[model samples]
Target chain A: MERTPVLRSEWLKIRTLRSLPGALLALFAATVAFSALAGVSEASDPGFDPLFASLSGVIPGQIAAVSFGAMAVSSEFHQGALRLSLAAVPRRGRWFAAKAAVIAAPALLVGLGAALAALLAARAGLGRAAGGLSTGEQVRGVVGCGLYLMLMALFAAGIAALLRSGVATLSLLVPFILVVSFVIGDATGTLADFLPDKAGQLVLRETYDGTLGPWSGLAVTALWTAAALLAGAWRLCRRDA
Target chain B: MTSIDVRDLTKEFGGRRAVDRLTFRVHPGRVTGFLGPNGAGKSTTMRLVLGLDRPTAGSATIGGRPYPALREPLRHVGALLDAQAAHGSRTARDHLRVLAASNRIPDRRVDEVLQETGLASVARRRVRTYSLGMRQRLGIAAALLGDPEVVMLDEPSNGLDPEGIVWIRTLLRRLAGEGRTVLVSSHLMNETASFADHLVVLGRGRLLADTPVRDFIHARVRPRVRIRTTDPVALTSVLARHGHDAQEHADGHWTVDGARLDDIGRVACAAGLPLLELAAEEGTLEQAYFDLTGAETEFTAQHQEA
Candidate 1:
């Protein structure tokens, strides 16, 4: 099969499922609702960072994106469609690459949308409730938030590829993103900044500190995503489907 | 000719052997029936042949190449291992469409297969709403979408009604008639009796019989002359005297093997044994299968004792 055709086939397989729309809706709703709420609450604090508050929606919204990524690959195993897929493109590496590319497209689009919506909602809500973020800081936060969400989605896609089970991927990822980040952040104090979510969130901060700057934090998250994807690719290629 | 060839193939899961030293050849222009009971390494062998499962030893090739080596695998070999494994939300047409896209099969060919498989009416319906038989048909349609040179179906008749079974039989025969290699796996011998010209019977991960269907049947199935007589014991004795193997059934009927109707009549007349009914009973494929696998049957006697 031609590369373009394989990609098209994988895209159709990913999009045809009802779960994709459901997951995308969940991501949108969570980002909008949480960012709006965070923006309003943080408006009263004196040292509140409007940029960070605006991007706060990503904390919860990424779970939806993670689910989307997980289901993209896991659905094949669940439905036994992987057999058909393998029958068509027997070259495992090419098939995996096609699937990865197709999955990344939606993840990137949905993640960007969620990140943009959250940033905008938080900015409007916080600006009206208290004071608006400075123009430069606001732009940095919005851009960083978009990149952060995309990286988070890719990270989840890697995890999904490794686990190859929707429930297992969700179970493992939810705690790491939600609970572990808090536990490590509270216990390690300054050291916790290196955690995946914490390090990645540094990009959302309006004021850039020498410690874990915006671009650097985004790079950290990208590195994590890259490492996970490499591991997943290795596992996928070596293991029997 | 397009064919599937396995040479000393072996697959091991942990310490247990799933398929051990398995070797077989399925040639084109004939429907090769793969027969085995449940857990007899049938699916494992197929997985190995398709390169879905790695072999611990040996190799399986299709059309002289491994499955993973084919540029367009579906065009070379179409396989349906599971029928109800498709996404429940996708429509039948979409399911086939996605698979067809992999091989660049035209949209018109998709519709043709749907029409051919009688799934055109329900083509737009979600697969979740389909019955098992309908799903089987859809799976077959998906397999045929590429118009592959070799088609392998694992238990295609499974979950089919009588009419569906007949339809599948005809379809397989037609595919083989077109000179494509058609390999169908079934536990039930009767299902493949009329359609399969060549038979590959496996028992406990070992090849029991690999020969023509007719030859296997004739060698394994014992034809009996069913005789109804007023004096069953007398007829049995008379048949035994002629060196024929005869047994008196519980229903007071006599069944004599290795003897024709003429021999039975002659023996009966000489012994003055009155025969009410005498006819040769043609053995079915099921009986032939039982005789072939009778020694290897692990549960029959246990069930009888139970």
Candidate 2:
């Protein structure tokens, strides 16, 4: 198939690596298992939302996707392959753009797959308690969750590019995503609503809180990704690799 | 003509100067061996030429333009800075394929390079599985994938075995024979002695000498003439009178400097000295390199400082 040369090359690089597939498989397994477990545990709860339970797998699944995205660029630096890449495409900005496009595709696909699998598992496990979701709400929840995962992955990719170390990027990303968000949510009453994960979770809810609606919350999460990516691009352009 | 030009390029790392006011030209149709000890700025100079690192002052151009300004730079200049710097998880072919794709080079060219560098047998294997020599071959293959006009390799034979080393030497000679400019950096003077047509020597971030390889070898290396005679003491005195320094070895042989074999034989005949053996001892390029850059070698000074 005819494709942009840089993007096609990046896609080949990502798919050929053993870690990329391993990460995706782990994301898929973790999402499905977590959702199934959540579904079983909440089967008898009075106000159980099947879709919500199904999508709960995204909590852990995002980590895998984030690592995949981060490794996509950082591995090049670690391996010294970035030198070859730069020698081929001397325009740094265009190379960054192509890398972003290549990473975004699988992220979106796997994310959507995980979200869908979680939703289906939750629906099946809930049995009679599962309410029929309206077509609009169902679409929003599924697409929003996928979009959220994609942006989260991009956020990790940006941080990895900036730091240029896999361990350091993971150390920083894990705490911010898994722990600091909760700490801030408990410590600050209203300000915590703006945190990426919290803001992103708002999209999966059918009922609106006083803060933001589904699409707006997704938009906020996208803004966060864009900001991080812009910072990464700026660093990439100005700094010597 | 495709060539590399550096105009007063200087780079500083913090307070330490890595490269200072270095300017030289690498012309096509010749192999220019860049000689320098560690921290003498050979790699830094190559990085400046490739635009991988920014120069604090001055500019470096490839084919009359900045490297970054070139459209599809690999086609103009191909470089291999570090052989082992590649991602370990990637297969050898995948590594070359990605780089070729970026330059819009066809996949066939990637295969061609793999075969050319004798890496075709291991093309499907991951780079981590390859030994150091194999990895060096892969790096060279990647550099050649673009079929570039100018090729630069820094310390290309650092970890290679004897066979691999010979392979590289031959490949570099063949590349230059095809009318491509090949610039290779090495600290081993023996490695570049017979392979390089031109030499650019660096010491303490400064250009020490840039001349033809033959001229460099001849000017810096004095061929020692060894002679064994019954009257070694008399011969030593006669050589000293002729302004030639002769040192008597413990084995009763006199090693004379600044005199060729013919001159030694003529002197011995005239002085009525019967010589048991007389021959010219060719000095290695290693001794010549030491004589040229030993005084200004930065790594040695750093060791002393430490």
Every candidate's lDDT: 0.81, 0.83
For candidate 2, the TM-score is: 0.92
Residue ranges of candidate 2 with Cα displaced over 4 Å: A1-3, A43-50, A186-188, A208-210, B227-240, B246-254, B261-279, B301-306
Docking class of 2: medium
> How does candidate 1 fare on TM-score?
0.93
RMSD of each: 2.4, 3.1
- Tens-place lDDT digits, model 2, residues A1-241: 1238878788888888999888888878887788877876745666555566767788898889889878887886765567667767767888888888888888888888887888788767766655666677767778888888889888888877787766888898888888988778656466787887778877876665657778887888888888878888888888776
lDDT (Cα, tens digit) per residue for candidate 2, span B1-306: 799998899999996889889999999999999998888999989888888788999999988999989887888888988888767888999888888877789999999999988889889999889888888888888888789999999988978898888888899999899999999999988888768999999997899999999998778888789999998778888887778888888888888877799888888899999889999997778988988889977656444632
Residues B201-268 of candidate 1 have per-residue lDDT tens digits of 88767788899998987787766789898876676677777888877777777777766778777778
